[model samples]
Target: MSTVEPTATKRFSFMDILKAPLLIAIALIIALLLLGEYLSPGFASGQQILRLLIVAALMGIVAAGQNLVILGGREGIDLSVGGVVSLAAIIAGNLMGGENSGIVLAILGCLAAGAIVGAINGIGVTLLRIPPLVMTLGMLGVLQGLLVVIRNGIPSGRAAPGLSQFVTQPVFLGLPGIIWLWIVIGLAMAFLLGRTMLGYRIYAIGSNEQAAFMAGMPVKTTRILLFVLSGMFAAIAGICLLGYTGSSFANVGEQYMLPSIIAVVFGGTALSGGKGGYTGTMAGATLLTVLQSILTTVNIDESGRQMVFGATLLLLMLFYGRGKALRA
Candidate 1:
């Protein structure tokens, strides 16, 4: 049997588009956008869509790291993303003190802190043979505790004026800085996954770890690098979140942990790993964000939304759990 791959041709028939996960995700995004507009007048306005896109951009940034780790195989995931994001935001807030002069240093500090946490996680998983789920989950708790110690159970600090402006004010093409940043990230991910040696090796490991190892790939190091990158991406999101909200809080990023994963899966990245890309994740993030907004517009309370998210994730996990058997 021959597989009609989506990428096999530049042109896709309607049936082919329907069968492609990435295309499905994009279609869902458009459908949801229109749905939102139907539910609330002006919801699909250019300005409103841009605003929602910024929110999706933040989620996409965080999911970017998750995408890579999952792509690296070995059940690799970063459950600690929310904690890393919260920690980075708090630390960046303190470092920035709302001053432009401190912006660069705050960014450096947050990225470094996130990278260290990621390095430890990578070492634990890659070298110590700790399961990715267990390792990242444990790190989440540690980071939460650390946040308390750092802020003494109180949320403090402010995003620099410049930072806030970047996130909220138009910078280029009438889009905020975060949108531009997200574009850069998406482009970079495409290049890394499509053109780089590291990208090929990552895909190789994900497809078959034992075979990759036999082929002399540095599997462990690549996995470690993926986690490190994940941490850094989460940190960047944290920084952007701080700017968007204009304040730093202990639990500011608490909401993103599962959503990041959801975005990755919804974007058509299989939780079982070995097949996915940032493009799908971007569409997933946008669709999720728009769907959430529509839900809110319809008066779904926070708890209700949480339930929906939880249920969605549960269903996906169950499906993926049987993926191999299904394929067989």
Candidate 2:
């Protein structure tokens, strides 16, 4: 009877600790929304809320990929995601040429491009023993340079009409089709991370790569695959951005890089790796979106917004960074 009581207490304590971050994110989201409502009339109205969710969905999509790489450990990070996103959007735009007929091809091309870039990063990290950060940072520069050469300072084409409509137009339950897309993708990613052997291996490797390798896990391959997947997700996000903006521009993805990282980290995912999931990332994304809306409603200028954003990220990093250091 005493043993059983201790076991139950341990289990309950573990569950509470596991749920704490997600609960905090949810609470923050609600608090921000309430604040928005107080500061601006109609701030919490259905339409405005839906818009915020839509934006959050975009960030969540990108963060989903970042989550995977971070989960792969070895200081895995994809700084090239922004460049891949920009390249994918530009390619998709040019390929689609404002026509629905080529949308499929455009999408495939963007994904392929992303995969190739990711593969390069993987090779550098795994085969050449290059650091992940350096490899990805170099890739980012290369991709940006290539994009500039390709576009020659002038980008062309527009988003396909159908694609644009799908993203912006209302669909089921008055939500935009893009929101539905995000939900579907999020569910799939959740299932992949939570219910699959691959996910198990990823966590194992992230927890301790040398130990995982000794235990016969395919550490190198898994890390490479994670990078590839991250690139693909970034490409998908770029495609969505194209739909949202209805045009492509150089460095269009510049805005997403930090936000995606922030979303992942804010969701309790460890930058050192192996300690978080997409669920928390989703909540974090929503929280950031709502916070942005609140700031905008309060008429915060661009410089003020950037200052607040940086300060917030710094604080979160300190909070989580300490935990990571302590654990180490």
Candidate 3:
């Protein structure tokens, strides 16, 4: 008997995986204010870059969770992510009280609360026969309602003394601590996705779920696990928000949902699932943050900001969406 070689299928190169629209978005962002230097000198300064990092670090953490679920396939998307963040913050605030003594319990409580909420999302999608979009959206509203009820329209609890200091203070190297944290998260997630079998399964499932199931991948279990991990990441974001602001608020996580989705999508992760990485998501997050900073420095009003943001998203979808369709 002769041994035979296994044939390999063609895969997209890393650069090939990145679509043209993403490149355009990046270029547009870079040159958005080049023509206006006379009107606003030093518009893109080192200080501005640092501010972008600070904002991206906060938004990217939540995007990290969305990255995992979207990459896991099965029409998977978490609409409840913002809700989880908001509710977790509220829970942490209520449990932590104003006293420094309650800090440990509050942190633990936040983690548990996030996990529970994520589990509900997982169950609804996987076991209850609800589409992920519908299930997560419903949960989002429910979670928001609960947060309002719990906090009674007021933000509850001040963050722990040490956490507030840690987030706001520059590290020994003079960069904000949150930036360092984001770096660490990027590295860790990269390692996890590359080194573990779990990571392979996630990619496999996203690429082709029925085939993955036929290949004996633990489909449902993996979904639950992915959701749980997503919840954990969202909780961490809420915690970071609290530390950065020195207080917890009911609205803290409300702003995260779209940015998170946009970051992951813009990062080149397939919204339809499969074929993307933390590198893309991180870069996308950075670009979005920079765009916002530029807009603010130019004194774009609230309506203007919304208009630009929506327009950018629409362009990204038109271009990046093609790449995704091609991948499929």
Top lDDT model: 1
| Per-candidate alpha-carbon RMSD to the true structure | 3.8, 4.2, 4.3
lDDT of 3 by residue, 204-275 (tens): 787878888998989888888878878888998887788777767656787888789888877877788876
The superposed Cα distance between candidate 2 and the true structure at residue 132, in angstroms, equals 0.9
**Comparison by TM-score, 2 against 3, better one:** 2
lDDT of 1: 0.84
TM-score of each: 0.90, 0.91, 0.86
Best by TM-score: 2
lDDT of 3: 0.76
User: Whose lDDT is higher: candidate 1's or candidate 3's?
Assistant: 1
Of 1 and 2, the candidate ranking higher by TM-score = 2
Candidate 1 weakest lDDT stretch, 10 residues: 4-13
Q: Order the numbered candidates by TM-score, best leading.
A: 2, 1, 3
Residue by residue across 1-328, what tens digits does model 1's lDDT show?
A: 1653333222223443243566767776788788778888899999988899999999999999999999888887899999999998998898999899999999999999889989999999999999999999999999999988989844588999999999988999899999999999998987787667888787878777998899899999998999999999999999999999999866788788988988888877777667777887898888788877777776677999779766755664453323555553
